[model samples]
Target: MSTPASRPVTAPATALSGPGSPRPYQSYVYAYPHKTAYRPLEDRPALRALWAREPKDALSLYLHIPFCEVRCGFCNLFTRIGAPDELTGRYLDALDRQAVAVREALGDGTPVRFAAAAFGGGTPTFLTAAELERLCDIAEKRMGADLTAVPLSVETSPATATADRLAVLAERGTTRVSIGVQSFVDAEARAAVRPQRRADVEAALGRIREAGIPVLNIDLIYGIDGQTERTWLSSLDAALGWEPEELYLYPLYVRPLTGLGRLGAAGDAAWDEQRLRLYRAGRDHLLARGYEQVSMRMFRRRGAPPSASDDHACQTDGMIGLGCGARSYTSALHYSFDYAVDMGQIRRIIDDFTTTEDFSRAEVGRRVDEDEARRRHLLQSLLQAEGMDVAGYRERFGVVPAGHFSAELERFAARGWLDTAAAPGRLRLSPEGLAHSDALGPELFSPAVRAAMASYELK
Candidate 1:
């Protein structure tokens, strides 16, 4: 297994300029320009077909916990803030019903082998110790008896994690915990509406470590309104001092319908060049401290293996989701549900449910044909720190990457954006390329996708 401290720091690529400079207008539309259209979950016929055809040993799971003590200003995830006692009981009842419904839809005899199971949102720890255990038990019963041995992960806020809560998670098969430690600076934390004190964070970390979980992934955000280069760098240093097994560095995105979005709309917030500089400075600081860039917004300690990287790849593979406001994806379709209804009312209903049915898969193959080549290139490039292997591409896609992306490859090479000579079968972003990596996805998106992404907003 690779350790996180031994990876080399590649320099960021210089800006791709001149007449052929990759135009932002072409790609800056959707959060995921190439994302498949929303498919409703109520389409029973299609869902049945999916269950019948799904490979028995090839599924994963994602469970969402939607209770938070306070809502963060920048958060756009599906979660509710307020009293937990009344909410937990209702949410669990609804979750159980949904699980049963999915099980029945998939059929009882189907053998499901989950590659990974992740608990995310509000805070998995928001549930009482007993409730958490019961939820995991129910999941194990539905998936199989040996879920504990699988790669299980959960996300929690530092303020919600206690020694008891951590112990419950450890006993229930959690191998990793992603704590939302957005910033170590008190002012930044306050600005984000995260009520975590520095002491609270340290205590939470100590408890989680004591529980024997091997991977501790911490999240740090940059490009917020009140954040400065100095504060961001200092937070980075503070996070590193904790020696987390992995780290996710995300640039703050102001999404509509959120507090931050209103601020941006009112001209009180802006993601300017200085914010970009802060992100770059923080990235450089992480790299200098022995963290390897794993994705556009993530870094891990050097020598860490792919398995130890953030759970992004596992998520990409596919996962079954449980709970209200949870999303699930198979090889063919993606579905999600809204679970913010009256918990009291939901508990009374035996068939607790709210779902978006399947929309369309008729164009899947067509879109795949048009976009798969680049999608694979970008997905692999975006997730794996080692970059794409030409031989692997040929083996999987039945064609060399150069055959499809040769023009783009040449364009990057001319600007010193790639180190093509290091190995025949490998292509990695040059340091300059890393700096502008977010632009690559947009640059490669098709015109239709670019247009669709531009006007889309997450609801």
Candidate 2:
């Protein structure tokens, strides 16, 4: 998900240690151009034709549930506040229709194998146990993806991670479950516009563990109002107490249209320094506690079951997204239903999606030009702890990453953000560079994409 409005100001590298280091972009560039760059398709294309030549042997499947119990203040994701009356049933009904249409579009000649699957959104667990079972049925019976055979992950919230819902997930072969416990401290949670008691969070975590999901992932946020180093560590220690399989530490981004955005929290030198300090402290603490860094925000407990293949490398494979907030990627284009952050706009889109009869054409998306594709290939791979594989890039694009992104690579190296010497053939970020991933990601964006994303109108 991309924030529809606001991009942070770029700061100099020298500002890292002091009051003026560049504001952390923390952009979470999971996908290139992001959903915000998608525009309505004037001539929607057939899904069959769109994905005809795309590789399908090992694909990733993502299902989005755009309803949450409460909207977090810093959240700019495309999800509505709550599902009222029969909304959940209606949404699932629409999802079933979408699954049927997408499956038909896959064509019968070649089998599309889903290697991994994930359910994410406002809160997937907000649905009833029966509703979740229906969700798994849509994935298994309708789409023909074997949930039991592949690694499946689902996202839940502290308030919604109920035992009944978790049992349904576990029975449906969910290998991992991620819960967002933004803060253990009630005050900090309130500051983030998320209300929850530590007791509830603990209970939810206990329930998830009891559900027997092999991997449990916890998400934490740093840099919220009234959050101090001591308080941050307390939250960290509390999260670590459960010995989660994975942990994601996110920096608070006050983007436009969110509650915090309305509060007018602008990025500044002091704020940047504080966040960086907290981030490093958290990073070092995790490193010393027998966890391995997967990326700037993700840490994995040693020997924990691998959550899933990081095949979000959508540049090379195909993906089928089955909800309003979900984005599907093909070799040439990325598409989804219209995206909006405002609750009214989100509800409108969801309603429209549920009622739609035509699901055969691509509706809203941006064309992935060759230049953009290379940039994506590099961005998705380079941001990982393992870094981009030089051989793999050459095999896929017929050119070395350095040959195409030499100028950008040189600049990053000069600023000590990337280390070509340590990794040899691969391009990897140095520790200092990884801390500024937000800055590094945008700096690599193609000028055309940057402008296109910038000009998109937000609700």
Candidate 3:
């Protein structure tokens, strides 16, 4: 197996333009310090040893299907173009092997109860109906994660969200189906290097409705090359037409190694302002239409069922990831197969993952120290609209977040980004702060983690 040479990921002093400025869209703090921060374990820890003391209750199961019909330009996710004919079958077989190994590692008598589950990747729907059924069986039978008892979400693309696949997902008790409709305008879609027509996207939406899934989430992108306020509103209106249970308005970020990155697309002050404007506009539009703001990117209809339960948070709750791209999380460490954006590197890693006979040890990961865990808990909690529970933080870490992150909190409060007055027991973000979440998230990363992630092998 080959990996890229290491290089520190520290940004130049000049890159940080002070806390007052709207920093460039550098990162989205989605799943706690990203997989880039993870490195090969010098001594691969046995699964049984690593998870021996971790909580079995409130676990989340994530299945990664790293295959897509077409690669989106702006996307830097660890997924490859469509799998060849027999490759899908082999991949599922490998997944089954991994699941069996993981379940066994949980200990024969331990009862691991999963509170939530998700199928994400290049696209979960890329698999055939039969293949999807097998995927469900692996989750339910091999891993023993009850699908019907918990909330299950699956991601899909228009081309792959076929009727047959939807049928299998619906029958298997999928509560939420998030479809990537990036944009309703054909021009914007083409500009993003994700080719799809309005008619085709509409058809896919219709099919998803026909599948009888309870919740529908439509994802749209803002700040494309030629996207304007009018076009953005049009896309917003189109999404609202379905009265989707949830809507995610993502700001376009041209990251390194992505198709847009190769072209060196818009990454300037003007573009940032445009994206911010569009985001606010979209947020307000959704709110006016009876959608509640979950975060800067997510808005849900008031009456819609939640995407995940109130009790389960991926950062706090343990997760078992089941594919090459998936990252399994324990309280102390996050582990997964090597991460790569290049197609050749991804294929190599996937090939290794599929051929591996031993699935009892972790190959790549970073140890999450106590401080880092606190930072992660604060980040995961504060980023959401509901905010962090001060008493809960104290209960877990024996200190309040405000005192722990005093300097950062002071800066955010001084800048009017933190709403401390609203809830004495919670630490939440102000509207302005949520709007600049990308910039704020990176600021909270510990220096060591920043350097490690910066030094990660991109290819």
Candidate 4:
């Protein structure tokens, strides 16, 4: 393992220029550029090697269901809208086959102990109750019955989450469900291309709770065109009224090829500073109502149930992303495959399984060294409300964070954006830091990593 080097006397500060600075905050837009570029699978050997190296108990599984009844204009995830019934049936067949193939590729002796399993997509509930049961049966067989105690989470749209679907999920050991309740107001919901009624949203929650599933997470979006502060506040109030175990507050991002992107280009959609102000207001409202800020975009009731604690950041301690288009990372190399339903690439990856061998040890070592310790700490730290644990950092990375990013840390500290304490040794963001957390990633990412990521083409 590499140790953190002592701080140099002089190191440049990498903090982002403030919102209105000449070097506008968008300058860091591609700081952590998408390495896969949404391309098809071409790296099966590396991915398999990563899975093999990961401590079995450290792995987590994510299954993506890409069929949605209606496409939200703001959504850019890999999902098929209005997919044919035959295609849905075929997709489930492919999923089962893929699960079996992964099991075989992982080999028999590898003791894979999953800590968490999540089903996300267009909507996992889009599958029929029987289809979901079959998929669960496959998972139990391949991933093992031992996962019964693990935290299994699934995401669903309110429209798809019927009582039957919830019951199927409960039978499959799912402990939590995340429903996309983008807004409580019907007009705003329809404008965002999510036509769920307020009554339907409440009804879904009532059913999930009645089914005895312990945790319910509601997803809310801010920064949508025509979304007013008053309307947004009302939505937040409605969400709080539901008392979900967790609340995910996300800002709408208009990705390049998404429907929202077209609207923006035509000058029909716009998100300005006022939208950001609304975000801050929403955050304050949630915090005032006793929701703990778990991440930049997530809030949860204090003392949330254990099941809800198995979030992406906490589970990042280790994850074994399976399925097409899933990314897996161990303590060493990071490897991913694209399964965005691109037919040609999927065929190529499936065929390559027979030809490709394990990744070279040297290659794995290179990636580990290339991953800057300070950058990783910052990435994980900013994601949590409690911020970075200095002692934990020293234990894991064998270095003091202050010694690693001394200059940048000092600069932020001086600006009163960062607060550090002794004894337990944790660094947390001050109020100003919380307000600017969205811009922290670009500043903390190493330039070399950013450059390298920018140069990689997905296809």
| Candidate achieving the largest lDDT | 3
Q: Determine which window of 10 residues in candidate 1 has minimal summed lDDT.
A: 1-10
Return the clash pairs for model 2, or none. 15-21, 25-438, 26-438
Per-residue lDDT over 33-152 for candidate 4, one digit per residue giving the tens place of the 0 to 100 score: 233322233443434555565556445676666667876776655555654536556666666665666666555566666667777766778888988887687677865633467788
- Runs of candidate 3 with Cα error greater than 4 angstroms are 1-19, 22-24
> Count of backbone clashes for each model?
29, 3, 3, 1
Q: Candidate 2: RMSD over Cα atoms?
A: 3.1
The order by descending TM-score is: 3, 2, 4, 1
- TM-scores, all candidates, are 0.79, 0.95, 0.96, 0.81
Among residues 3 or more apart in sequence or in different chains, the pairs in candidate 4 whose N, CA or C atoms overlap within 3 Å are 325-339
Cα lDDT tens digits for candidate 1, 84-112:
34667766766776666666666656565
Predicted candidate 3 versus true structure: per-residue lDDT over 1-459, tens digit per residue? 000001112221225445556464667777666777888999999999988988887888889888888888988788888787688888999999999999988885556888888898878888989999999999999988889888999998888889999999999989999898989999999999999999999999999999999999998999999999999999999999998999888888777788988997747777878988899898888889899998877888998877686667655889889998888888888899898888889888888888888899999998999999999999888888878888999998998986789999898887788875667887889988888787778888999887887676679
Evaluate candidate 3 by giving its C-alpha RMSD to the native, one decimal: 3.6
Q: Give the TM-score of candidate 2.
A: 0.95
The better-scoring model by TM-score among 1 and 4 is 4
Report the CA-based lDDT of candidate 3 relative to the real structure.
0.83
